[model samples]
Target chain A: MKNNLIKMAIFIKTERRVFFALVFLFLVFLINQGLYTKNKITSQDCMDGKCSALVPEKPQLSRENSFYYIDDLFKNRPSGYYRLTFQEKSNETEKIILKLNTYSEKESFVGELTVNPSGNFQNQEIFFFLPEGFDSLLFAKENSDSDGNIFIKEAGISKLNIESEKELVLLKKTVIGDTKTDLIRESQLSADYIYPWLKESKTILGQIFRSSDEYISAVSFNIDINKNLNPGSRQYVLSLRKVKYDRENASFDGQIIADLAFSAASIEKYRQNDGTFLFPIYGMLEKNAHYLLSLDNSKVSVDKQNYLEFKGSKNNDSYGGGSAIIKKEKNIYIIDGDLYFKIYGAEFHQENGVKILNGAKIEDSGKGMGKYSYAAKGKFIDLLDLEISSPGMGFSEDSKVITAEANDSASFNYTVNTIYPIGKMNFSATQLKAGWKKVSVKYSFNQENWFDMPFSEGIESRIDSIDNMDNSENSDNDSSVDNATDISAETTAQEMIQVFDFDIIPTMKEIKTVYFKITYNPNDESKAHSFALKNLQITADLKMK
Target chain B: MLKKILEILIFAITLAMGFYFQWEIANFVFFILFIFLILHPIPSRFAAGSAIIFLLATAFLTVFKQNDLAETVAIWAYYLMIFTAMLSFGELRKEEEKDII
Candidate 1:
């Protein structure tokens, strides 16, 4: 009995020891797993500094007209000043650096500097130093000029440090520039000159499509000088005097459109049609005091043949001058000069009751007047040059119709080389004439054997709608089929349909070309069935590749 | 005594295998060890020594090589083992005192 008790005691002791050893191993495994999990969590959180980094919220600025700001400086404007005030926090730093970021068309400006504290140590303002010339060149131009526009996205102070006796203390507070009131404003003006004689003006008493008015004429003149004139001796004055007719109703009108003036000169000599006394002027001189020499219209002889005369002389000349008789001849102005100038002129005319300048080479080519039509067509009109093809009849370019005559059935095929993966086919058909029509597209990988192209859900829905419309139209006039003449009138409306969401071609692998086919057969043997199919387009998912 | 030694040997082998093949077996062995320590009466000094050895081995393995799922299991098992060791030691001391009385 004592031996049995000893054996049981030994067994119990061994079991306890085994349990302790196993527990020890378990504890070790658990500790290792815990450490691994902790590391994993830490690593995941470190991505993009999303969980670890602290980002400050930027202040919002109120914008005017979705563009201008109330207190903001105009971008690239001269003297563009912005003051950034820093609110004193618990962790006061001795030196704070303010960073500026600007984006402009010509150049991008990025600047940073250590800020100087204001009078009040608690509140600090940093002024952005912008030069006058820089602002004028950058901000003083139109948006279309392609220069000098700056957009400030964000600005903030970083690396803020305080110097202590022993060490440098880094502040955790982030200083963000107050964008609400920090902006510049700029104002500018632009001007252009437009001549009244060149522009066409509409008249009330004119036909909408055609006008009975004839083309009118106007005259212009130019002078080519042979001798180079000194800067101080090149001044001249040009005058155009009209004949004194009824004064209220004059047949011819004359005006000096443009005069290339000289600086300061006296006329050396005067002759008639000699062309040897004029001098070539190089550059434009500063516009000094000049005179316009006028001739007395009442003293001059006036007649129907004698219309107007152009005269040019030195500004200081009292009597003799260069003269040219102005005459209009078939879209041209012939200037017959009595001295050294002869000008091939431009003509102005009246077309369709509106005055138009024809021969003058105007710099600005304005928009043309739209053609006026008495009868207007449909707004959605598409002109397509399509090549219609069939099996036995071959192909014809610019064909408008694919027809089946009498009791015959016909199919027209159009081959399109699709470099992209086409998902749907769309087309419009006109004058279907109560006929059975089937439209299908087949794709080829090797250009030898063709398989039907698949369609998407959108195309399937469009096809269903087209089928429904045909059924509804057929049911409305069941007796129209017996009368073949009525079929043409009934099917005059064009039908547009998109074929989609088909499982015909499972995979479009290297699909080089697709043939779109339209087959038609009329129910009646007496009637001819014809339909014009146009504007065939295929949509593709280019992103799939 | 041989059975107890064989049991411990098998446990050590399974724990090593768990690190390579399947770690679930090691976890199962740990549960059995915890149950035995809870139910059986042992000396407090012995249990304390075993706990210390287990903690040192766990630390070494964890620092050297470990996986995600096993690490998670190890962490929970660590806390459970610590609690069971403390409870078993306390029970052992009580039993020792009763035996002395």
Candidate 2:
């Protein structure tokens, strides 16, 4: 057949070269699937994590214009208790007298304040105590009569933030802790040196001062109720008792200790038509304290407009430290005058200043978020403000701290809503094991009233003969230094930082929210100890009424 | 030539046992080797030129899809109906010849 047409033209030219090499390999696999579905940028686009930040620098208490100089501060500083909060803005009603010299310019030992300005921006505060360590830190407007030109501005000299919060209806807030203590005004007399006296509460109304220190949350009393109330609400009750005496100081164990029900209508609005308003009771006082004003008014009807009048001290001993009584039915009259009260005292302030807690606000107390964590059995660790309990604690903003292993039942807790009036707390641990009562601290504003804080061996710890688990049970006189430093938490020099301090204010006064609970109990001559506590500081003592 | 190399060595051992076994037993051993190579044959103008380039790229990708491709144009219309049944029973029912399985 003509050789089959030459074998069909060489099999159609070798099947057209295998269909042109499989259509050039399917057009190079359709241009590699269209460049892998249109590119993306993968392998984790390179990775990250590297940081560094710090900004905080704006607390200026400046004044280099002839009037408020702080001799540039540093002249061997640390003498204790300092305060200066400036913000004046006058151009008229002036009468400034803010001196604090020394180093011989001695303008009367660190303390002075007498402003009388009007025309807006007026916030002039002063509280001082240097005890020898100051030559200049000025605000001298020592009154050259009236050459008004005071414009101080947001000044700040914070050394233990002071403002023993005075507010018999002055409600200020903010600026808390560390004037190093003092603020006892027991009777420095001021409401124009005390005068009014009207008396009426048919019975219970004693007033016995005398606690110049040790504790006293709030107590100012200028008396009121002249609206002759047959009104709607009334329950003024106020008790403080615990007056025990014998060593010739008299007082006699009055017992009671805590109760303050207030409401002269939150205290006559404030200076309600003058004479001298004043009103504050807030408890936690301490005679070890005794104060009473209980007036149930027993559903009024004896009519003198439902009675409410108290303010005495126009004469008689004008308060040498105790007087003014009424207690009926068991009789005890004695009232010649002496009830101008204002003991505000409540020390335990802790403010040589160093607070350094490190948690960065850990969170997860059911989504307070802040940091988040989860694990069972009371593993809540949520510290927006704070809470504390431990078992194998764990919180780590890259190791700020919450660690555990050393025990004495060591307790620490934190929380704050900040309405505050008094507070004092401290902590610094490496392996804290200061014995005697081991260590027990308790505090609370609403954690169901815990209160137990008072361990201050006066502050001076640091006698670690090897701890953090007492070096594997006391270095046993050499078994190779007890298994080579046995496992007594090897090093960090016994984790030294020690500080424990906890006096805890009178008890409770103007607290909106504050929670503290510290614990440490393991001490039966130690064995297998462990410790490393970075910080716990919660210094409180801010007042504004 | 040895039954065309034993039918391409049993379709290359059933496509390598359909990639190592159980591909539904390689689709029942390639449906019994397609009933023993359904009369066999193999070249019909290169399978009608690869089924007319997969029926014009799967009918221009199921109807002018314009580059929108992540494969499924009904799997290239089932590989253009197996190359249009190898150009209809492997060469238009042998009207001319060559091309079958």
Candidate 3:
């Protein structure tokens, strides 16, 4: 009994030691868990002066001829989050304000100011937040606007100011270079000049003047003094008149006249062109003018000519017309006349010093009225947007389809464009029996050889395998067992979507083309299987070279 | 002593088989071995203690490694521990009844 007591005591002592050890382990585990929870919040180190700014290279396409512009200052000008990083100087507690000026078709005047802190060259992120609900107002009209133009005169961080209780002073400001502004204005001018005539009809007006035997058409133009001209010439107003097209009447029934005047110094430079200078005359007419407007006589002396003449072609009526001009070789007609013109004034303050007087007149000759028509054989249709569907056809015929009776099969061949990496093939089918059908997919770079597609293990075949088996062999089987199997198989077979993902390391040297075969051999020959494939969309990953 | 040795040998074999094949056959064999162990006469304290040790050791080895067999082994060990505990409780009750008589 004494020996038994000793053994019992030793066991109890060991158990107490183990209990203390377990308590220690549990405490350690709890401490570790607490540490992990505390460390879960991620914090970025911000000591370097260099920081990332959200500078969008391309404008986001918001709609047709409308875009969302993003920059450091105009980050929230578009309805999207623009995340930018700024270096805060260490130990500096001054409040910094980022200022922005924005212009759009809806509103010409929009401004925003955001307060930030300077933390002594520490990298910090500032988010300019604009939600999706405000996207409509944020989207500015692109240069392709049909009406008057709205262009970005200035963008980006216009000013960064430090604020104190006493006053606010500018710390840094973005200066837009003259060359950069010129480039922007040049692109905007191209869009304004070309886009209108490229599309359908819009009302364009000019002036025509008839003084005795001479007829002159004058149209006002805002010529960029900084571009395509001599250095000394600040501004010039040109007066000229030429033939104009009347699209509705299918003839040249009107004359355009422009009376141009320049600052006295610019006038001397304008005459130095040696009577061979050509200026573009832009006009708009009604749709369906039957005649092509061109200069009739090329031999007209440029020195003697004071008015340009445009002749109309003898073609049939069409639906659209563009800006017209009358020219003799490269020389345009210039006439002395009274000027009345519309001036598209420069908006930016930098170009405020430039000045000019411009005028134009238009006169209808009433000789261009006529009726015309043309006939064609067949209609040209665009198939890209056409959605083709057939009723009672289980699926739409947007893709290829193949129908096979019992013991029959069909194959489809597709040529890949090879521009992107082939990712996988997704195939879905209806009316497939679970145990009775077996479908296999294979791919090959070259059509001569084929290999089975890499599929996950235990994935059942889509085609019915029982259709290929002999029907006479299972004559004695109990119907109840068959019925139970059929019910379970039917439930499993109802999942018709199957994805054959490509292998991690594809073995094909080059994927040029692929062929898919669908073999349907029904166990019962009486039933015909109809498979209408909606699409065999090739999923590809774009590879950059 | 012979029964205990046989039970241990069978458990080791099933554990290895479960790791190798990861099939239903190993699970079936383990189930049968558990039933045999439950039916054989053994002390309740010894049975409960040994079952707990075995379960803990198996779980500790496979806790970090995840796959088909690891999952199956973990599940089988849990079920075996539960059944062994129940059997051990029954044996303890029988022992108490005998003492009372």
State the C-alpha lDDT per candidate. Answer: 0.29, 0.41, 0.29
For candidate 2, give the lDDT of residue B7: 49
Q: Lowest-scoring 10 consecutive residues by lDDT in candidate 2 chain A?
A: A364-373
TM-score of each: 0.18, 0.23, 0.20
Clash tally for model 1: 23
lDDT of 3 by residue, A354-408 (tens): 2110100011111221111111101111111111111111111111222122223
Candidate 2, which CAPRI tier?
Answer: incorrect
lDDT of 2 by residue, A301-340 (tens): 2223334555556465666556666555555455656665
- Superposed model 1: Cα runs more than 4 Å off: A1-411, A420-487, A491-508, A522-526, A543-545, B1-101
Best prediction by lDDT: 2
Candidate 2 off by > 4 Å: A1-68, A74-239, A242-254, A258-415, A418-439, A442-498, A501-514, A518-545, B1-101
DockQ of each: 0.02, 0.01, 0.01
Best candidate (score: DockQ): 1
User: Of the pair 1 and 2, which is ahead by lDDT?
Assistant: 2
Superposed Cα RMSD, model 3: 37.6
lDDT of 1 at A110: 25
Q: How do the residues A42-143 of candidate 1 rate in per-residue lDDT, one tens digit apiece?
A: 212333443332344232211211121222233434343333333432111122223232333233232332322232223333334443433211111112
